[model samples]
Target: MNYSATAPYVWDPNFADAPDCLLSADQCVIQAQHYFVKGLIEIPVIGSDEVFSWGVWVSLSRENFSRAADLWDTPGRESEKPYFGWLTTELTIYSPTTINLKTNLHTRPVGERPLIELEPTDHPLAVEQRVGITMDRVREIAESLLHGARSESG
Candidate 1:
């Protein structure tokens, strides 16, 4: 209704991390509020202000991945094509160290009376901003999970 009053602040986040329009509208809204109050100041606010997003090392959200696949199902128009692949917003401010994050998803099939149930396990996924993440992080998590299952097997 009032463009002047609303024009004081605008939201501009580096969506270099987000590949698609998914469950991050709130993040952008908060960033807009942060700018409204701070007036173009580059400061990392505590308690999840406009800090780096958390999409750097996580598996691409199913929605984004599907969108990318559909959009890029052709070639020769790659550059002009919009990029909607992977979770790009998530980043690790501190990386190249032994620290990492990982997760596991397991499912068990049940009988006719019961459907399938899913179980999730997580671990540290090692990553480097320069080169990105490697399979070691996944393997580490999987191995740890396997070891746990083995220990509990017998």
Candidate 2:
């Protein structure tokens, strides 16, 4: 299963036309101040080889952002250290907000999106990442997103 956010949570459509801002399929810069990168928050599926993933964005420091961009097309970029960032996408299916979660963006091979590793916290999303989620949970999330359910409780 896969879900995605097209841009950062703070993205403004007007930024698209601003000379100082940039919005692309895998990267974003708002007002040339806020840097963001798209990555995957993957969860293992219990009893299956399949994985569930959220194609989300995370805000990064200017230095980290520059470093990532410099290595964008470089082979073996996956060996580079992960960049610290804050989760910018809101996964409405989770309660108590899914924004601002701590994350580490691990760059992958040239063609793949970076991997987002959430901090090991008590948050349900983090817990699910650390442990594995069942297929039933995946279906629940899919249903929630597909039906526009506001939160997991719904």
Candidate 3:
């Protein structure tokens, strides 16, 4: 399953016309203050080689965001160190919220989204990231997302 958020959770439509604000397929800057980048958070699917991914936005520090932008078109940019960020998408399937979780954005080769690694913790999302989830769980998630089941079983 792949889910994506078009903008950061803090984004507001009012800023869409602001000179200092910008939003693109993979990058964003709100009021030239909040910086964000799109990345993939992959969760392995058990009993198979498949993986579940979320095309999520993560807020990064200005310095890290600048560094990432500097290398955006540079080859071998994947060698850069991962940037610390906070999860800015709310995957409502999980309780206690999926926003503000600690994360490390690992830069990938050009043409690929960065990999988002959640901080190891007992949170359902983090737990699923550390340990693979069953196919049944994947189906449950799919149903919840597709059918608006509103189940928070994660």
Candidate 4:
């Protein structure tokens, strides 16, 4: 369940900011400078035979981020990567209050965590949920979204 073997992408939340919005409807922000480990992740799709490969975008508060960091640093966390838990939060986007972030820890219910699932791609949230990444090219789309939140915050 861990990606320690692959040295999965891990983010350093030094630059991540607290959840703060000037207006009621603002996107969630990453806060400070974060570092990415750059690796592949397998996303499971509910009720589907296919699994998606993508870079994981961990969106969480500094506290939760710290927890994730600690897990990543664990001696044999790679092979046990999928064990990384979840962090839940609500982010304001567009309107005063929008975007409910649910952590999809391996233990949680399907389609609830931040990682994307394919079976429900038709769902409105599916688009935001899917993020693809490969060894040759690490998709920055998710990171860009993380950055966008930063820009909107200021």
Candidate 5:
């Protein structure tokens, strides 16, 4: 399940100049991105008006923090332990521009590329996925009603 809960702190630009801590543990909700005394990961779901990208950073645990540097220094092991590293994606929208990010957007599986299940190219979302305009696809469909440009190519 998507464990999406904001921490006790509120990072409203109107209220605080920076990310501010609000509630204590128990009362605190695990936020999407914010450092805490308690170990909490900040996953960045990045995307654009015409593109989408997703990433998650595991909040460093005390046990994991110390060894994090060593593990992090090692190459060819994005799926290793001690520190769960960052994963970046190049969003391409094309002849099939829109691409499907995996169910766990941030966590791409070990040693495999995320797959996109293509449906009939009809809805803006389907078209976007089919074409490859991802980040924008999520915003356009999930939150707002934006008409997207048609494309048979990326």
Candidate 6:
């Protein structure tokens, strides 16, 4: 089945009420193309008052989503990191809002399955710093997005 053709855009739960600009995947086109589960998360800091933020935009093919769903219900999905294919691109930082700092991820991968390079590199957020997301949540968001989109289209 063509998942992208069926799915709608899924906004981050925290930013559901916020403007679409702050969302990482708001710019994505879900049609005959790929589908994505996107979210933004605040990086917790212990010391200073400056707020840091991170965003995750995981791109999934229809087949990949099915595989991920199976793995999600399995006991040890965590060990299989990068369970879903992701949009690999630079992390963009936007000016702070009155409430908190914001970050956006816009990745339109040129190749197939460009999993992020996760190492202790110069990147602002390390692999460990990347937010933990479950495959179950991914499926939930996609389903919600698709259902909403279908409702509107009808």
Identify the leading candidate in terms of TM-score.
Answer: 2
TM-scores for candidates 1 onward, in order: 0.20, 0.95, 0.94, 0.29, 0.25, 0.32
- Model 4, position 14: C-alpha lDDT score: 40
Per-residue alpha-carbon lDDT of candidate 6 for residues 1-154, written as tens digits (9 for 90 to 100): 1122211224335544444323332223233254454433333333344323334455566665555545534554444545334433223221121111132222223322222333333343442235433445345545765787788799
Residues 1-154, model 3: lDDT tens digits:
7888899999999989999999999999999999999999999998899999999999999999999999998899999999999999999889989999999999999999999999999999999999989999988988888766444343
lDDT of 5: 0.31
Residue 123 error, candidate 6, Å: 3.2
Q: Sort by lDDT, best first.
A: 2, 3, 6, 4, 5, 1
lDDT of 3 at 133: 93
Pairwise lDDT winner, candidates 1 and 3: 3
Give RMSD (Å) of candidate 6 vs. truth. Answer: 15.0
Record all residue pairs in model 3 with backbone atoms less than 3 Å apart, i.e. clashing: none
Which portions of model 5 miss their true places by more than 4 Å?
1-51, 79-154
lDDT of 1 by residue, 1-154 (tens): 0001111112234432444422231122222122111001012223333321121222223543344334433443233322222122222222332122232111112211111111122212222222233344434435654676688696
Which pairs clash in model 6?
A: none
What's the residue-level lDDT of 26 in candidate 3? 97
- After superposition, the stretches of candidate 6 with alpha carbons farther than 4 Å from their true spots are 1-29, 39-55, 61-63, 88-120, 126-154
C-alpha lDDT of residue 110 in model 3: 92
Query: Is candidate 5 or 6 superior in TM-score?
Result: 6
Q: For candidate 2, write residues 51-112 as lDDT tens digits.
A: 99999999999999999999999999999999999999999878878899999999999999
Which one wins by TM-score: 3 or 6? Answer: 3
TM-score of 1: 0.20
* Ranking 2 against 5 by TM-score, winner: 2
Q: What is the C-alpha lDDT of each candidate?
A: 0.25, 0.95, 0.93, 0.33, 0.31, 0.38
- Superposed on all Cα atoms, model 1 deviates from the true structure by an RMSD in Å of 19.9
Instruction: Compose the digit string of candidate 5's lDDT tens values, residues 1-154.
Output: 0122233223243433233433333122134243222222222234433334222222333444334334434545345422332111212322332223122212123333222232444744344444554444455443321122233232
